[model samples]
Target: MTTPVSLTIPTPAEAARWAPEQIVALAQANAAAARQLDALQLEFQAMKHQIEWFRRQLFGAKSEKRIVDASPHQMNLGELPVPESSPPPPAKDIAAHTRRARTTDYAAGDASALFFDEARVPVETIAVANPEIDGLTADQFEVIGEKVSHRLAQRPGSYVILKYVRPVIKRLDTQAISCPAAPEGVIRGSRADVSFVAGLITDKFCYHQPLYRQHQRLGDNGIKVSRPWLTQLTHGALSLLEPIFTAQLDSIRASRIKAMDETPIKAGRAGPGKMKGGYFWPVYGERDEICFAYHEGRSGKHIAQTLGTDPPPEGAVLLTDGYAAYERYAEKCGLTHAQCWAHSRRKFFDAQALEPERAGQALEMIGKLYAVEKHIREARLVGEARRAHRLAQAKPVLQQFFAWVDAQFESQGLLPSSPLTTAMAYVRERRAALEVYLSDPEVPIDTNHLERALRVVPMGRRNWLFCWTEVGAKYVGIAQSLIATCRLHDIDPYTYLVDVLQRIGQYPAANVAQLTPRLWKQHFAANPLRSDLFEISK
Candidate 1:
């Protein structure tokens, strides 16, 4: 069926009765509306271009180092010929002392040069007291002065206070789990504090220092432990905890909503420049628990294997940036892929950094989108409430915003070699993922939660440099995971590690959930300082 057009013009007879100017005015009005529509369309396109540029700079394939501005002093004046025949300036003449004015011009009558000499004398006094009396004796007074002089000895600098709280692990005489025996006289040792030993390996050896540094401290504190022995303990602890790590990975696979991100760690086994970097991929659940995986590579194949097969268990949504690997993994796993809008917005923002005018127009439009998100976030809406609110307030902005993107991308020479072109491409490619969050209450507006988590890698990187081996990198991943998890739970990492090392063996495996910072908070919430009861004896 053909639908009839909506608008109808007045009949010719009625049109003829109207003045000629009225007809012209009507035509002008229509032209003005068309012009306004065209302008709005251009503004939208510019916004999309700006947003896309930032996306590529951040999460897209276009990875290039941003050029830093040179300081004024750093600017070079082009090469110049050496100066020829420059002569040194002559010295200035000085007034002679004899010619200079003086106040003492009068001559005195000749008199013998007076000299006064007097005999010098020295006086000394001594204090005395009986040895058994309250008053000081001669010997006692000498002793007191000697002690005072010693105390008054000059020093170069004031002492500095070294504030460090020692770890508090009570010596519990306990039995360890029995395992198959090594050869005879192997000197089998039971590392009762396995978790702490893990921390020692991760925090000290793999990350900040070698095991010997820790061993030296132990020795200084009168604990006679060898570095080789500590290394053995670390290996043993990791071996014991491997199963728990595996179980945690299994738990992460069970989650419906997961956020995944990867960071590179230099694995020392790989040859210099030829070194293969390991990836710390954390797959976080919406619930209190998280699972971390350290993989040898950051390829799509690794991601697919880690996240599992296609047609992922029900309610699965994988959130990530515009990394193509993630897209492939999502496709292979049949998991719904959600791209970060922050990544999209960043594209434009980055372009704006280079091209201010185009970026300004783009930012104005994006600001509207953010304003709406900010409103919804401030309202603290979640689930259906959030989805409904976003659909109503934010959906139209997104539609208009994307439509603008489409028009810009279609135009020729509008993007070109400009980074804004890159930004535009990202929006067009991931438009569907960008919009999914508006429809689903569970989906976040962005993947910032996970990105923020990944920042720890860079922070710790600045301090400790790089991982020594694949095993060492894996240990770092484990420690960073626990420390980050503790931060998420609002627990002090040092205290948490110290407590775990001291009590983990006695802590029931079934109650491991309680050790998570969130749960630990509840147990100690009423009396947060309860852990302080176990302090190091001076």
Candidate 2:
């Protein structure tokens, strides 16, 4: 007694038959499942790409150069039927030639010329006697012209502890004791003098030396200085320099066109044995002066605060990377916003690993733009000439590039999350900003200038690691700003810092511009007191 199961086979019509409500529900469920699958796939792809990016950052060629030999005419995405033509020649049939030998000129002329122009450099002459006439008497030796050869030399810097002896003198008539007031030192009570403080700041910021190491160096030279004391001296020096730094910032802000960028630095302020991230926002002025400002975070508010004014001086154009923060700040301030073409190209360059064909096309087009820039630079075109050159050469290339981008979006088969799609969106969004360079000669095509100026922050970070506190980071920014600006003007940073430190206390605050590296070069560089560390050959 088990009831036999009825074995039945359903007909095609019965199998296909279903209630209308059931059919609709089944179709809706199928669509929902597909949608979920697509979402998961998109998420997975995004994660994969992110991991790949990190891997490349950790281990990849640092250079972004891409070499392509094909002509621009060959860079089309269309597929067409092949036309009948002569067959291509085999590689073996091609002609070959011997490689040319490369040579270098190593003969740097006249050793004396190196120090000849340095009037302040002390010269010591060593006389060499003729070996042929040994032990020649004064009567035998004849007074003749001399032959001299010069060789550059160096020695470790000498440090000394100056003990100022101010003798007390009494006036005979008034019976009042008076002594020449001791010359104003950078720090009144500190043992360190202006030169010492300037050297410390220069060594720390310009040479990327840490205070503890500098302290040890001094100890090795028989001068035992505590790290804390050195730190205090450094802070004091920077405090004196703060006014100059502020003046430079104001000058940079007043410029009609400027470039800006930021780099992160680890500042030890979170807690003991911990560090917090901070940023150095560097601004490049029209006259090639660079100013770095430190802030706890990279926010639009910090940018606004740094500028210290709304509606940035008329005709102001701020060139920067396509950071949304800049856009908001610019909009609120009524400043002209220009984006970096190099940044746009960088996006496409990174995408090359994922989508070579599309990325290469974008890179080639962008390369054309850079080529035009190279021509403009080689010609030293400026103002109207530069704008006209861009209009004539770059405008057409840009038109074609944008047209290609539009066509890519309109054509089917590109996923929104694809690297190429993302790059296209990035360029399209910043198209107006990117084109600003074509219209204005003062506006650079990229913010690479400011980025290069800010590189010192990262390089110094590599050597000195983190600043002890947020305030320390700010001081670092102030010192680095002056040092970098000095370097930009081909001025010796140590000399500039030392002279500025010695004179800044007495310099009128209203005329601080004279103390800046630019004006200092024009006025004080020719002074006999200028340092001969690396004097230029006349």
Candidate 3:
């Protein structure tokens, strides 16, 4: 019922005698096929690069440092090429230099000497008797000097109750009774001492101990306390500290140069039997101070609100990664946006396994930029001098690097989806923002500082898992902000928290800035709380 279709095969002579238009069409078809093949090859390369990236993340070393090879053919981004051979150096005329043995010994020699400030640390002296002189009498031998060594000891944490004795007196005239008032506490009528509260907080946030574990520890130590009670005590302490936390935020906002980053946190109260995701946006200030702000979502509006304006105040330079939200915020707020070079470098770093030659070229150029930064940092250059140095050294490298990126993009005919093409586009789009550092000495080359600061949150999350409520996560952010800032300034978190907890109530609200870690160091540099005071009474 259906007619069969037949095709005729053309001979070589018949095909050659075809019209000019038909020949042109055949040539165009072949060209199109060639283009498609090229596109597919590019896509395959991109997929290969992606697979390598995942493998590196899952199995390879986490460090960004590339391995060094000693082979003559090895290439290095940080140094010059090695020579094939070198001449031997001239032999020294005299014997090789030798030094006389020194008599003075600079070794610690004893554990007690290991302490930089022995006066600050508690020391217990033990009397040692010589076994050779058994049953020695009072007139046995003269004592010349005693060798002193110390073994550090620690006592398990235990709860102590302070019985405040307020004497009550009765007046004979009117039979009126008067009693001495007790000092104000972090939480009124709560039996927990300020030091106890501080220890609980530091244990949870700084040491990454969960409150449940601490509760068990307390019970194991023969102190009966409920987990809920401990949680309440922590909340109460954080409530009192809310003002100081606010002040720190204000201080951070007032900074001219700030670095911003965000990390995830899980809040358990968001849904029934399921955890709700949240974010903690950590902002690092110009003075090395860091503050964490909690938000339900990582959006530009939340960031804007935290900074206290839709656009941050004028004259502020905000450093961030290549997040489009940040760019939009910067554009709206009129703030100087400085993108992170380390972020751009990471793209090429990830592509190295598949495109080593091209990636290495890009990395070497970026490495030169960092080398300039290293030189300036080593010289301790700042302000105009730092800017001048960057202009003199880094600006030229940047110009050449960008030009090379543009050339590669135009001439290579890479697919749009290729990783290398994506990397080039990333740099090409943010070229101006990346160059902001060359003009302003205040801007850092990367957001590595903020990224490093964010590590604490992730570590804390691993131990504690998640917060019970949004408010609890916020409290965590506040406490962690202070603790991390203390560590940044080399201040002991326990010492800072205890002192601040005891004094925060008495400190005037208008003068709350003094309670911040950086300002506190300036005010209390010479009179830090003694380490012995942090110890529990025996």
Model 3, span 1-538: residue lDDT tens: 2222333445899888999997777777766667777766766786787788788889999888756448877656767775778777878787688899865433323443432223233333334444434465545444433444332222225443333333344444455545544545567886565667778898899999999998877665445557898899899999888888899999999888899988899975755788889999899999888989999998888779777674455678999999888888877878999999999998888777766778788989999999999999899999999999999999999999999898987785566776777888999999999999999988999999888887899999899999999999999999998999998999988778777877787888899989899898888645654222234342
Assess the local accuracy of residue 44 in candidate 1 as a C-alpha lDDT between 0 and 100.
61
Per model, state how many residue pairs clash: 14, 0, 1
TM-score of 3: 0.75
Cα RMSD, each candidate = 22.6, 13.7, 13.3
What tens digits encode model 1's per-residue C-alpha lDDT throughout 90-139?
Answer: 88999766666655332221122111011111111112222232353434
Distance from true position, residue 216, model 1, in Å? Answer: 7.8
TM-score of each: 0.58, 0.75, 0.75
TM-score winner:
3
For candidate 2, write residues 1-538 as lDDT tens digits.
1222333344778648867886676677666666776777667667777887888789977788996666866745565556689588766766889987855333333343332222223333334444433454555444333333432221226443332333343434445544444444667766565556777888888888888888777666545456788888889889998998888888888888888787899986677777899888888999989988888888888887777664567789988898999888888878889999999998899887677898899899899999999999999999899999999999999999999999999999776798889999999988999999999888888988887788888889889999888889989989998999998999987778767877888888899988888788998977724322223212
Candidate 3 least-lDDT 10 residues:
149-158
RMSD of 2: 13.7
